[model samples]
Target: MEPAMACHADRTAPVFQTKGLTKTYRQGDVEVHALRGVDISLYPGELVVMLGASGSGKSTLLNILGGLDVPTTGEVRYQDIDLAGASDRELTRYRRDYVGFVFQFYNLIPSLTARENVIAVTEIARDPMAPEEALDMVGLASRLDHFPAQLSGGEQQRVAIARAISKRPRVLLCDEPTGALDSATGILVLAALERANRETGTTTVIITHNASIANMADRVITLSDGVISGEHRNSERQDPNTLSW
Candidate 1:
């Protein structure tokens, strides 16, 4: 294999980083390039928003960043460990220990209460917050006894967020976290993410197409055609409650 990409190689150890990351897949006789030479450095305790359209490689980058998938060519590093070059067992351990992911769908069990969902993850986590503590963080203390079916879209997503972060992960990756909810509901979910990032100092990256969501981030990264098109550093993060549709 060729040496790892050098785009961000010389930078200081970041919370998470990618150097010349690239991914391609074979579709019959044709090759589809999902990501093309992406480079980024995510700092600890920063909230980053990734803006991109469909087929723009946002999900591909997030997947690789989360250790859910490896790049075809590139170097992904978390602290001192090289993710791109890690073995399957190493990656599994990395994901289990360092990364927390929240997807678009809540994916909660129908029969499990909000607290139960959070506890499931805490049970396996090395050092985890109490399930009730996590629920409180998301402002769900009053709804902890409610099942998925008993909660609204926003509430269910908050449960998902609590479950992901109960382990106190070093990094949190969210992909279109608010895609399924209305604007009002979506802001609530975004608030949960912001609180987690601020309180725990977990480096958080959220992928979304909604420009309105960008204001809540410490930095905004724009991707197009599998390449980074723009990078913006917000002077100040916006309060989710202050955000409007």
Candidate 2:
């Protein structure tokens, strides 16, 4: 959807906008095109779900949006910052200050407790929520002292989410946040994400291959062969507890 069609009436400028975005890599003699002229505008405080199969370029787009990578030939803007033309140092600062990322794997330090893991990011953030507050948002108030090894996979993932949101980032980018869990556990994780989005009002983008997850988003965009093939708006978001794989 265009930036003008924002779900929130107060939001005028898009948090992220990309035009003719492309990413190409040379693997031996073959040129693999991960993205091909993708154009999208993600608005502030809206939950967006990008549905695509394997190698459909969703992850590549997320990486570029998160400042982990840059587009080859396009204009990528995060508000007024030009991401496509940014230097490595600028990109680093952009990521640290404005973006929060959650991946399929919970990359929590094994030695750190849940609170400690969240503290690691908040300590460096310009403005941060208390570690307890973040964990409470995810329904993990009682597990503050548990280490990664002591927590279940879903619990560990929740801890990771707590850590990401603790920084109070303007945007939260999640790549397959529930990919590693079973249906029931995945719902819990999705609920945490939904809670985070609802409570914090962060512009959230979740990229996944599962079509069922689309019901929980304000907007759903499908990618095929590196381009956005379909886009739609959901009148009302379904609760994550009601969603099944």
Candidate 3:
């Protein structure tokens, strides 16, 4: 294992920061703790991979960071915005303007062409890339006219990525992005994400249980039982094409 790298982000302010973050959900008779005081920072233009098994609270953390949910306690800050205290409407605008999300499943519209699916998001974004450009970034230029059914699973996922990035968001959040794909197909998707981060300089965070995927990240944070267990920075990122799991 590589030794943990020192914090080099002090020169630039973090794009997102959290302190004493916690979330609790009530079930029929029990209260489940999803997060137990998570404190972290994400810098601009860095690729981070969070590793954890199911129920490790990675998804909960991602949802809060994306403004889809609020923490029960503690501060969640996105630059100068107080995400933890933001109103529903403010969070909506923050998600719309600054955050982009890609999920494990490709939620492409079956009725819409690949380009059209991406255009759906671009239309609502404040300042967006051309739908064609976003699709092209993910190596889907040739399949723009194809509907979801006409494309392969990997291609459909790429379309989803294109849709998320079309808004030119400052932060890109991916939740198990390659979870549904075979190793070969997953590599392609990871490559597209790497390209997007490099080209657009979007701060990217990918949450997955796959440890192999961490090799491509600038930093890797491990979560266990709703708390951060370890963290380390890679001296260099490996090419996604060379990764196998």
Candidate 4:
């Protein structure tokens, strides 16, 4: 594994920092700007909600931060490492070591039990939490032996979360994590997220279309047309019960 660059900043440093970051995709004669000169920072152990409409570039930004996509211009640093300039292998190692991701779809293997699914990641991880412990963290202790087909949508999502977090990554990025569920079930997913963030102290960034969900974040950022339009902080977080749709 490549050694991480030395960090000059103290504990106040952000887990991720982007300055004038931009990403453009080319298809035939047209160019699409998914993100436009956006500057942002994700702090350690804070839950941030990225709220916006469909074309707002929230997912694009999250993808870049997660090292799945690269920007066409500008700078992005993961801690002190230069992510924007990292080679493919370096980026792969970075993602493998420090990043955990959850998406809208629950991509578990139908034949694997919840604990087995979590173990799949733990095996490859450098230093991971026990699969059973991870499942318990997401309130799936009793369902550890259940297959994905037998689990509800919310339960499946929790298992996914357990799988992602079992590696004990420094950052957890979720893109539309609850988009597929009804409100009541979605709250369970949100509660899982809240519990994971509080207990593990992992820096988490969530991208969602629901404005009401922003109330639960330590900070909320809104995007529009590929740029950040607004950012704010809530003095106190609202529990899942208090969060509206």
Model 3 lDDT per residue over 1-245, tens place: 44332323222899999999999999989999999999999999899999999999999999999999999999999999999999999999999999999999998889999999998999899999999999999999899999999999999999999999999999999999999999999999999999998889899999999999998889999999899999998877888888889
Residue 51 of model 2 has an lDDT of 99
Between prediction 1 and prediction 3, the one with superior TM-score is 3
Poorest 10 consecutive residues of model 3 by lDDT? 2-11
Question: What is the RMSD of candidate 2?
Answer: 3.8
Error of 1 at 245 (Å): 3.0
> Ten consecutive residues with minimal summed lDDT in candidate 4?
1-10
**Cα lDDT of all candidates, in order?**
0.88, 0.93, 0.93, 0.90
Q: Rank the candidates by TM-score, best first.
A: 2, 3, 4, 1
Pick out the ten consecutive residues of candidate 2 with the lowest summed lDDT: 1-10
In terms of lDDT, model 4 sits at 0.90
- After superposition on all CA atoms, what RMSD does each candidate show versus the true structure? 7.2, 3.8, 2.9, 6.8
In model 1, where is the ten-residue run with the lowest total lDDT? Answer: 2-11
**lDDT score of residue 98 within candidate 1:** 95
Model 2 TM-score, 2 decimals: 0.96
Q: Give the Å error, residue 110, model 2.
A: 0.2
Q: Measured by TM-score, how close is model 1 to the native structure?
A: 0.93
Model 1 off-target regions past 4 Å?
1-12
